[model samples]
Target: MIDLALNFAFVAVGLAQVLALVRLVRGPHVGDRILALDTMVINAIGLIVLVGVKWGTQMYFESAMIFAMLGFVSTVALARFVLRGDIIE
Candidate 1:
Protein backbone atom coordinates (compact mmCIF):
# COMPACT_ATOMS: atom_id res chain seq x y z
CA MET A 1 0.00 0.00 0.00
CA ILE A 2 0.98 3.64 -0.17
CA ASP A 3 1.71 3.82 3.54
CA LEU A 4 3.99 0.83 3.30
CA ALA A 5 5.89 2.42 0.43
CA LEU A 6 6.33 5.65 2.34
CA ASN A 7 7.66 3.82 5.37
CA PHE A 8 10.12 1.95 3.21
CA ALA A 9 11.25 5.17 1.58
CA PHE A 10 11.80 6.78 4.96
CA VAL A 11 13.89 3.88 6.14
CA ALA A 12 15.94 3.82 2.97
CA VAL A 13 16.67 7.54 3.07
CA GLY A 14 17.57 7.33 6.77
CA LEU A 15 20.03 4.56 6.11
CA ALA A 16 21.56 6.52 3.24
CA GLN A 17 22.00 9.55 5.46
CA VAL A 18 23.72 7.44 8.10
CA LEU A 19 26.10 5.97 5.54
CA ALA A 20 26.87 9.41 4.22
CA LEU A 21 27.62 10.61 7.72
CA VAL A 22 30.04 7.77 8.25
CA ARG A 23 31.80 8.57 4.99
CA LEU A 24 31.95 12.23 5.90
CA VAL A 25 33.63 11.37 9.18
CA ARG A 26 36.04 8.76 7.85
CA GLY A 27 36.87 10.12 4.41
CA PRO A 28 40.65 9.93 3.75
CA HIS A 29 40.66 12.98 1.52
CA VAL A 30 39.02 16.41 1.45
CA GLY A 31 37.24 15.65 -1.82
CA ASP A 32 35.72 12.50 -0.39
CA ARG A 33 34.42 14.35 2.62
CA ILE A 34 32.93 17.06 0.45
CA LEU A 35 31.24 14.44 -1.73
CA ALA A 36 29.77 12.82 1.35
CA LEU A 37 28.48 16.14 2.62
CA ASP A 38 26.80 16.80 -0.72
CA THR A 39 25.23 13.37 -0.64
CA MET A 40 23.87 14.05 2.83
CA VAL A 41 22.28 17.25 1.65
CA ILE A 42 20.63 15.40 -1.25
CA ASN A 43 19.31 12.77 1.12
CA ALA A 44 17.91 15.46 3.39
CA ILE A 45 16.09 17.04 0.46
CA GLY A 46 14.59 13.68 -0.43
CA LEU A 47 13.31 13.29 3.13
CA ILE A 48 11.77 16.73 3.06
CA VAL A 49 9.99 15.99 -0.20
CA LEU A 50 8.72 12.70 1.17
CA VAL A 51 7.31 14.46 4.20
CA GLY A 52 5.52 16.97 2.02
CA VAL A 53 4.00 14.16 -0.05
CA LYS A 54 2.83 12.32 3.06
CA TRP A 55 1.27 15.42 4.62
CA GLY A 56 -0.30 16.73 1.39
CA THR A 57 1.27 20.13 2.03
CA GLN A 58 3.18 22.56 -0.17
CA MET A 59 5.27 24.33 2.44
CA TYR A 60 7.76 21.52 2.68
CA PHE A 61 8.31 21.69 -1.07
CA GLU A 62 9.40 25.32 -0.79
CA SER A 63 11.82 24.47 1.95
CA ALA A 64 13.14 21.58 -0.09
CA MET A 65 13.80 23.91 -3.03
CA ILE A 66 15.68 26.30 -0.78
CA PHE A 67 17.71 23.50 0.70
CA ALA A 68 18.55 22.17 -2.77
CA MET A 69 19.74 25.57 -3.90
CA LEU A 70 21.84 26.10 -0.83
CA GLY A 71 23.32 22.64 -1.10
CA PHE A 72 24.33 23.20 -4.73
CA VAL A 73 25.82 26.62 -4.01
CA SER A 74 27.79 25.37 -1.05
CA THR A 75 29.10 22.40 -2.99
CA VAL A 76 30.26 24.70 -5.79
CA ALA A 77 31.89 27.04 -3.32
CA LEU A 78 33.71 24.21 -1.61
CA ALA A 79 34.90 22.81 -4.91
CA ARG A 80 36.14 26.23 -5.95
CA PHE A 81 38.00 26.59 -2.70
CA VAL A 82 39.63 23.23 -3.14
CA LEU A 83 40.69 24.00 -6.68
CA ARG A 84 41.94 27.58 -6.20
CA GLY A 85 42.13 28.09 -2.43
CA ASP A 86 39.53 30.81 -2.67
CA ILE A 87 35.78 30.73 -3.14
CA ILE A 88 35.69 34.21 -4.58
CA GLU A 89 38.20 36.19 -6.54
Candidate 2:
Protein backbone atom coordinates (compact mmCIF):
# COMPACT_ATOMS: atom_id res chain seq x y z
CA MET A 1 0.00 0.00 0.00
CA ILE A 2 2.81 2.40 0.81
CA ASP A 3 4.54 1.49 -2.37
CA LEU A 4 1.41 2.04 -4.37
CA ALA A 5 0.85 5.40 -2.77
CA LEU A 6 4.39 6.46 -3.56
CA ASN A 7 4.01 5.38 -7.15
CA PHE A 8 0.83 7.35 -7.51
CA ALA A 9 2.43 10.39 -6.01
CA PHE A 10 5.30 10.11 -8.42
CA VAL A 11 2.92 9.84 -11.35
CA ALA A 12 0.97 12.87 -10.22
CA VAL A 13 4.10 14.92 -9.78
CA GLY A 14 5.34 13.86 -13.20
CA LEU A 15 2.07 14.91 -14.82
CA ALA A 16 2.17 18.23 -13.02
CA GLN A 17 5.74 18.75 -14.23
CA VAL A 18 4.71 18.08 -17.80
CA LEU A 19 1.88 20.58 -17.52
CA ALA A 20 4.19 23.14 -16.00
CA LEU A 21 6.67 22.66 -18.82
CA VAL A 22 3.88 23.13 -21.35
CA ARG A 23 2.84 26.34 -19.67
CA LEU A 24 6.40 27.58 -19.58
CA VAL A 25 6.71 27.01 -23.29
CA ARG A 26 3.31 28.38 -24.30
CA GLY A 27 3.05 31.29 -21.86
CA PRO A 28 2.12 34.58 -23.49
CA HIS A 29 4.46 36.71 -21.40
CA VAL A 30 7.95 36.46 -19.98
CA GLY A 31 6.67 36.80 -16.42
CA ASP A 32 4.20 34.01 -16.94
CA ARG A 33 6.94 31.79 -18.30
CA ILE A 34 9.18 32.59 -15.37
CA LEU A 35 6.41 31.78 -12.92
CA ALA A 36 5.80 28.49 -14.64
CA LEU A 37 9.48 27.66 -14.50
CA ASP A 38 9.50 28.41 -10.80
CA THR A 39 6.56 26.13 -10.26
CA MET A 40 8.37 23.41 -12.15
CA VAL A 41 11.40 23.75 -9.92
CA ILE A 42 9.24 23.57 -6.82
CA ASN A 43 7.53 20.46 -8.05
CA ALA A 44 10.91 18.94 -8.86
CA ILE A 45 12.02 19.58 -5.29
CA GLY A 46 8.96 17.86 -3.96
CA LEU A 47 9.60 14.89 -6.19
CA ILE A 48 13.15 14.71 -4.98
CA VAL A 49 12.05 14.75 -1.36
CA LEU A 50 9.56 11.98 -1.99
CA VAL A 51 12.19 9.89 -3.69
CA GLY A 52 14.59 10.47 -0.84
CA VAL A 53 12.03 9.22 1.63
CA LYS A 54 11.38 6.16 -0.44
CA TRP A 55 15.07 5.34 -0.76
CA GLY A 56 16.01 6.17 2.83
CA THR A 57 18.70 8.62 1.75
CA GLN A 58 19.23 12.26 2.69
CA MET A 59 21.25 13.44 -0.31
CA TYR A 60 18.13 14.09 -2.35
CA PHE A 61 16.79 16.42 0.30
CA GLU A 62 20.04 18.38 0.37
CA SER A 63 20.01 18.70 -3.39
CA ALA A 64 16.39 19.74 -3.25
CA MET A 65 17.32 22.54 -0.87
CA ILE A 66 20.03 23.71 -3.23
CA PHE A 67 17.65 23.61 -6.15
CA ALA A 68 15.14 25.68 -4.18
CA MET A 69 17.75 28.28 -3.31
CA LEU A 70 18.88 28.53 -6.90
CA GLY A 71 15.31 28.74 -8.11
CA PHE A 72 14.59 31.62 -5.75
CA VAL A 73 17.70 33.49 -6.83
CA SER A 74 16.87 32.95 -10.49
CA THR A 75 13.33 34.13 -10.01
CA VAL A 76 14.48 37.27 -8.23
CA ALA A 77 17.02 37.98 -10.92
CA LEU A 78 14.51 37.50 -13.71
CA ALA A 79 11.93 39.67 -12.01
CA ARG A 80 14.54 42.36 -11.51
CA PHE A 81 15.47 42.14 -15.16
CA VAL A 82 11.89 42.52 -16.23
CA LEU A 83 11.27 45.40 -13.89
CA ARG A 84 14.51 47.35 -14.31
CA GLY A 85 16.11 46.00 -17.53
CA ASP A 86 19.13 44.74 -15.62
CA ILE A 87 19.88 42.11 -13.00
CA ILE A 88 23.06 43.67 -11.63
CA GLU A 89 22.75 47.01 -9.93
The best candidate by lDDT is: 1
Output the worst ten-in-a-row residue range by lDDT, candidate 1.
53-62
For model 1, the local distance difference test gives 0.96
- Residue-wise lDDT of candidate 1 within 7-79, one digit each (tens)? 9999999999999999999998999999999999999999999999899899898899999999999999999
In model 2, the clashing pairs are none
C-alpha TM-score for every candidate? 0.97, 0.95
Q: What are the candidates' C-alpha RMSDs?
A: 0.6, 0.8
Most accurate candidate by TM-score: 1
